[model samples]
Structure formats: structure tokens, C-alpha cells
Target: MRSSDVSAGLAEGAGQAAAERIRDAAILRYGRDGFAVGLRAVGADAGVTAGLVLHYFGSKEGLRRACDAYVLSVIRSEKLKATTGGPAVVIAQLAEVEEYAPIALYALRSLQAGGELAIEFMEQMCADALEYLEAGVAQGLLKPSRDPVARARYLATQAMGSLLLWVSLHPEFHEIDDFRKELRQLWDEIALPALELFSEGLFVDRTMLDEYLMYVCDPPAGDAKP
Candidate 1:
């Protein structure tokens, strides 16, 4: 979501070809980490010079941003793929990929701690959820009486909080099944009520929504290439 030409998808691929390898290296490094990592360390891991990493990505922030873009691209193009339904349907589809939770936890931490780069990703996520909500309204997949943006926010809150709590606490319990059940109960019990309100009415600023979604979704093409 961090713009500035370091966007995910095809634009990312435009860098002097070695882009995918660099991106893959980022995946390995950051997916398991501590502290603000340095480009030199990442470059060493990638078997490339720090300058090469910088040259390709522009800055450490840019490299990190590219990493995010690639990860989100995977999420959107893969796990969160549109299936023919509403928000809950999309969530249900997403749940099938259990790996999403850990990665998302990392992202959540980044958003909470990071500056502009994190904010950009957060905006992209919110935009995508809002877009899905709007699509539901447009297709009459959801009730037309509620505010879409508010609804999306509620869903985001509940979903994210649910994942965080379950991931954090489930290990303390003796029976994993019980933990899963409790999490599902929270989803069915808590998330449903909030979604009901969304069904009544929810709205978001369309232009801002589009920009953010475009940033994350990596729509078909076009960007400044060097």
C-alpha cells in the first residue's frame, strides 16, 4: 500500500529483473525477525551488496514496503480471492488458510508501530474490506439500510481482534479443539451482532476507498519505471 512506485505487483516486477529474488529474500528475512532490520543484513542474506538492495528498492523503507506489497498481493490474489458472496463469505474463504493469522499478526504489529509506511498498508486493508462491503450493497448481497464504511470497520475490528486473541491465548488451553470452538463462538456470537448493524447501514468515501484499494489490489497495470 505504500505508494511511491514501490507498489506491489507488476510495478515491483519492473525493477532490473532480479526483483523477484530480492522480494523472496525479504520474505525470508522479515517473516521471522526482531528490531528494525538493516539493509546490509538483508543483502548479506540475499548474497548481494547492500547498495544493490538499495539500488533496486530505493531505501530500506522502500524494500520493506515492497515486501508488504508482495505479501498483500499474495493475500488478495490467493487466499482472499473473491468467491461470490458477502463479507462473512469472504472471511470464511480466508479462514481456510490458517497461515494468514501469523502473517497478519506481524502486519498488525507493524501498523501499530510503524509510521507512514504502516499507515499506508492499514489504509489499503481498510479499503479492501470497505470495497467488499460496497460490492455487497451493490449486488444487494447485503442489506441496503446501513453505513458501509462503519460496517467494514466493525468487521475489521472484530476479525482482527478475534485473530489476535485466539493466536495469543489458544496455546494456554489444554484442548486445542476447545480453543478453536471458543474462537468460532466468538466469531458467531460477537461478529454476527456487529454485522447485523452493518446490514442496516454502512458507507465509506468512494474516492478514498478506490485509491486505497487500487494501491493494495494492484489493478491490472501502469507505474513509473526506471
Candidate 2:
């Protein structure tokens, strides 16, 4: 390669490295301090000047969007292993990288903050779920829904709600002394079941749903006796 090309490649590599460092720092601080975590603090944590962070991300909102994208990408990579293991697996895996727990918490807090960032993140999540559900239907791995878009929304909402609830109740789980153990327990009791409900559903005899609805519309003669 030409010397100029080699120089350009080196510069690109260094830029990427700096960006990753800033991202990691932002994740740690934001996870611990929420979206309001100072960019200067994140830069300090990354061992980079605040100007470098600003140059890479442009603004705090830009950094937050980057974090959301990174977190979602990580979750997507894990989801590729199993159809319904994304949220539960991601939550459980965060225990392995304790620093990431706060990043997950930051995501939960963003939902309540209700800004453009939250909307964009949620829209991306729902869009991804819809794509996955549609593909599953084509591959015969999942039952086809009459309204796949609505089904995606419901599934995504359930997953997000379960994560939010788990993070919000962290204090109770923390009291268990072994948080990883308690988190796993909570996952089994809450997240796993919620995912199962989305994947397998609750009813053993789905045909009974029609029967029950019919009965609701017109009662049996045996039920007429007062």
C-alpha cells in the first residue's frame, strides 16, 4: 500500500479506538448517572479530552444515540442464537459484565424520560422485532399472526416492560446479598415466563378460545337454571 494510504488507515484505526473508549466511558457513567451524566466526566473516564468526545459525538444526544445503538446491536447479536432469548439473555449476561448493568438501567430510565431519543430507540426495537417475527413465520418457526405488526408491538412492549420492572426493583433484588443469584431467580420467575408467553403462549388448547367466546355470546341451556 502507498505510504499515504497506510497513514490514512492508521488514522482511521486510531479514531475508531478513541470512539470505543469514549463509548465505554459513557456507558459506565450513563449507566450509573443516567442521561444527564456529564460529557467531561465520560471523557475523563476514557482518558480523552472533552473536545475529543465532542468531536466524535458532536453532542450529548449524539453520544446517547450511539450508546443505544451499541446496546441494541449487542442484544441483536445475542438474539441470533435463539428466537426468544434476547432480552432475558441480555439481562442475565449483564451480570457477567457488571459495568453494563447501569447501561441497561439507563435504557429503562430513558423510557420514562419520553424524548425523541426514547421514541427512536423504541421504534427501532419494535421494527426489529417485527422483522424477526415475520421471518419466523416464513420459516415455520412461529405461528403466523393475522396482524404481524400489532403482534410485534405487543411482544416488544412485553419485553421492554419486563426489563423495566426488573431494573426498577433492583433494590429488592440487591437485598438478597447475592445479586447475581437473585437476578437469575428473577429472570426465571419473571423474564423467562414473559418470554415464554410470547413464544409459546398461555393456552394449551387454543381452539378453546373460540369455544369460550362462542359461549360468551350465547350461554348453554344448562346454565339457564337459576
Q: Count the backbone clashes (under 3 Å) in each candidate.
A: 11, 1
Query: Which regions of candidate 1 deviate over 4 angstroms?
Result: 1-17, 77-96, 99-105, 165-226
Candidate 2: tens digits of C-alpha lDDT, residues 23-139? 977866775556776888999999998899999999988888888898777655544434545446556654464433544555666685688888988888788788777665665
Q: Model 2, stretches more than 4 Å misplaced?
A: 84-103, 171-182, 191-200, 207-226
Q: Give candidate 2's error at residue 109 in angstroms.
A: 3.0
Q: lDDT score of model 1?
A: 0.59
lDDT of 1 at 61: 76
- Each prediction's RMSD over C-alphas, in Å, is 13.4, 7.5
Query: Please, what are the lDDT tens digits per residue for candidate 1 over residues 101-165?
Result: 33554554455456787777766766667766556556655544235566666765666666656
Model 1 error, position 141 (Å): 3.6
What's the TM for model 1?
0.56
How many residue-pair clashes does candidate 2 contain? Answer: 1
lDDT of model 1, residue 121:
74
